[model samples]
Target: MSTATQSSGTGTGTGTATADAADLAPVRTESLAAILVAGERPPRPNALQASLTFGWRAILKIKHVPEQLFDVTAFPIMMVLMYTYLFGGALAGSPEEYIQYLLPGILVMSVVMITMYTGVSVNIDIAKGVFDRFRSLPIWRPSTLVGYLLGDALRYTIASVVMLAVGLIMGFRPAGGVQGVVAGVVLLIVFSFAFSWVWTMFGLLLRTEKSVMGMSMMILFPLTFLSDIFVRPETMPGWLQAFVNNNPVTHLASAVRGLMDGSWPTTEIAWSLGWAGVLVAVFGPITMRLYNRK
Candidate 1:
């Protein structure tokens, strides 16, 4: 009887100790549950970091679909070859002279053309419901677009280099030396980056990638060809000259020309920068609004 009582007392004491410990210990609340109860959000990445993260994601996409670079690589090469051989003699009296003029214009057109891909990509993502997941994440919304634009910097640079290299191989020499060439490339990239906003807005507004590409092409074609890209506007009618002079593509091409030729025309550079700012101002907000709405 004594041993039985001692055993029972010890068991009861252990149970009491356990109960006290349980009561004294921090409540076994899940961190998530506690966070939810507190109505607190976990800290998210800052704008720059978030944008870079998204940018990295965009770069990674190239691994899975290397063909995504076809426009940047093959298309630029074909354009360079076809344009130099086909129109070089007729436009500037020889292939050599024409390439110097044509190369800069081609670079501008290529960059503008590729900006549409941004819209197409965004549209496809939206269609696939991938954006739905992104929307749910604790990220700065604008970072996604900024990230894509940053990621595409590589594509723009590659296209520019290819055009320049092809032009050089074909006897197109720049008077601007190394410094001039570097400046021209930098300016081209800046313009291209700003121009991408217009396409991003299109992506937000368009229903499908095809529609974005088609619509963008329709708009860009006129902007590129109607300017003084292939031929001088002086030969055209007065009204056509007026339009060409005012064309933004004309200013960009002229800026590129001056840089490559070592002339560095401040007026054209100012105009190109102004237009880039205008495009970003107009399209950036629109794209963000549409994205947030989605």
Candidate 2:
């Protein structure tokens, strides 16, 4: 079950969106449908095409609900205020100082939260016979399943940009300049889309949308708190520090922090991207499995 990979590169910094071709060597049989008519077989539909169909439908669904825009717009402001004025003095130095540190974390946090909504919406559609309609269509094995996630990546982009704008308005500035800020937000949305594959898998397997919401959150809660999302991981116990050190969210947060500070690091980006690839590898197939079951 493969979806499209997008590449983004700037003048000096060129990032290729190359899938590990070796990984695509064989696909799971469940990622296909078996059809026989008088000992004849049907040619398989391309998964990318199916995924894009899901993407287009999700975009259309978003248009129907104008309130979808409010999530990212309101969520960031509330989180910034709750974390800054409420806990800034105790956690960091001051509200202003903490925001300087907090903005990047919140940027990624917004992406994380936005992905939850994706799971919710997907589960809702699944429960309400949307997937039934989709199943009747000759869609790709994982395209509709994976494309739903890709569509939400656009929402993640909006959520990240909206939060960044709100942070700036509240005196949260990225010292890393415009390009750094762009890179930080881009990686965050990409990472969120990758992590969202976990939620997508759960949503595909779960029966109820509400259960999907709870279970999806149960999985992410530890990932959010145990990482460097709200507080410094260095402050954790030595045993926990090892976990935090290895957390992809921590690497993502640290990389964003580096970009915001206009500092360069060679390794954190790899750690973050590696985590994204891992999530996609593990959960992408699971989503395909559940999607086929439907």
Candidate 3:
């Protein structure tokens, strides 16, 4: 008899073969159907741990591309040195006096400027298709941005230290003792962290890394130079002075200068913190929304 006909019989070998085929058919069909229907869900990660993992990943990226740090390390030092020597005499009577006054302002400006890089980096990652991989992973959705912010904190710290060290070498002194310097540093880090959310939002909205960088400079220049970073706002036209007086950068600089000078900075500190809160409240949700949509 033919093998096909034999396999269909109820006798010993044929019975076993028929039974095996029956068992295997359903399994194969079900498995294929399951695959076509839906994939198994990946396990979710703990929110905090996932975010830190992302943060560590960002830190590791710098090892492979150390030039990523040029802005945080080199530019701030250049700004402190060049501005002190070039504009010190013209703006603050002498470079010596300007070093003291301008150092605090430069410190603030440097950290704030560094915030732009956060946006550029975010945009680059999105453009490179890395964010799509992140989306496919089972981690918390916001963890990627949170981790990036954490990594950028390291950048902010390095920039702050570089600015302070360069200032001291150039004869800048803080009248506020150790306690005051610490407070100023804490405030600077906090403000920079919050300001980063603004850039993060811009990164999500913009199409290209170059556009993000260009727009960031456009926004930051008015906020920094138009305020009191290099010169007294009062020296400007009255209309300009009015805007400077209300500028958030003005409050941040005033707060930093006050802390370093051992002066009470109740109003400035309050305003600085308020601006930080406002930036977080407004931009943070928008960034997350755009990220989810993208």
Candidate 4:
């Protein structure tokens, strides 16, 4: 009897210790089903999160699609030579004059053109239901959209440098030196960023990637070619000239050339940036509105 009592008491003590440990362990108040359901809620991105995520995605996409390098690395170089040597004499007085005037315009157009493809990628994701999957992530809702915006910045910078290198190779030196060149690039990039918001809205609004790409051509081509990319607006017809004169792209390109050639036009620069600011004011809200609805 005494032996049995001692054994029973030991078993009781062990059971009590085990119960205490169970009570002290971290508790998950929510069930697995509840946690899983919570994950289905859409993520909302903030500004910082959007930038970082976009930057990462942009870089990774670069890794997977090395073909993108052709655009930034090769196309601009060929374009510079094509416009400066082949078409220069026909369009302008001489190659040197054409190079000086055409450099800034081409640079601005390149960045703008590269960014217009954002809608294609976005619409592709939307069509594939990737965005809906994002909506299910617990991530910040704004992050997905904001990240896309930041991701494109890397390509913009790369494209800018490639074009500048090509221009340098062609004997087109900026009179204002490095600082002027940097300022010119900065102005164009700001303009590109402002322009991207409008495209981004299209991405959210469109149905298929192809449709968005087609619409992109409609918007991008008119904005770029109709500007003073190759020929001066003065050579254009009176009514057509009015439209070119008022074009924001023309003002931005002119300001870039002015800065680079040491013919800094403060009024043009201010007006160009004013245009960028105005675009931001108008489209930024529209993008957010569409993003939320998505």
Instruction: Tell me the lDDT of model 2 at 116.
Output: 79
**Candidate 3 lDDT by residue in tens digits, 1-294:** 698677656477777888899887755777788888797766667999999999999899987899988988899988988999998888778999998889889999989988888888899999999999999988889999988888998988888888888888889889997788889989989999899999998898999998999999999999998888788777899999999999999999999999999995999999999999999999999999999999
All candidates in order of TM-score, best leading: 1, 3, 4, 2
- State the lDDT at 83 in candidate 3: 92
Clashes of each: 0, 1, 0, 12
Give the Å shift of residue 200 in candidate 3.
1.1
Error of 1 at 216 (Å): 0.3
Per-prediction RMSD in angstroms? 6.0, 20.8, 6.3, 6.9
Candidate 4 runs further than 4 Å off? 1-46
Decide which is better by TM-score, 1 or 4: 1
Best by the TM-score measure: 1
lDDT of 4 by residue, 161-279 (tens): 98888888787879989889989888888888788888888998988877788888898899899998878898999999999999988999889988898878998899899998998
lDDT of each: 0.89, 0.78, 0.90, 0.83
Task: Write down the lDDT that model 1 would get.
Answer: 0.89
In terms of lDDT, the best-performing candidate is 3
Residue-wise C-alpha lDDT for candidate 1, range 65-123, written one tens digit per residue:
89988999899999989988899888888889898888988888888789888888888
- Candidate 4 to native Cα RMSD, angstroms: 6.9
How well does candidate 2 score on lDDT at residue 189? Answer: 76
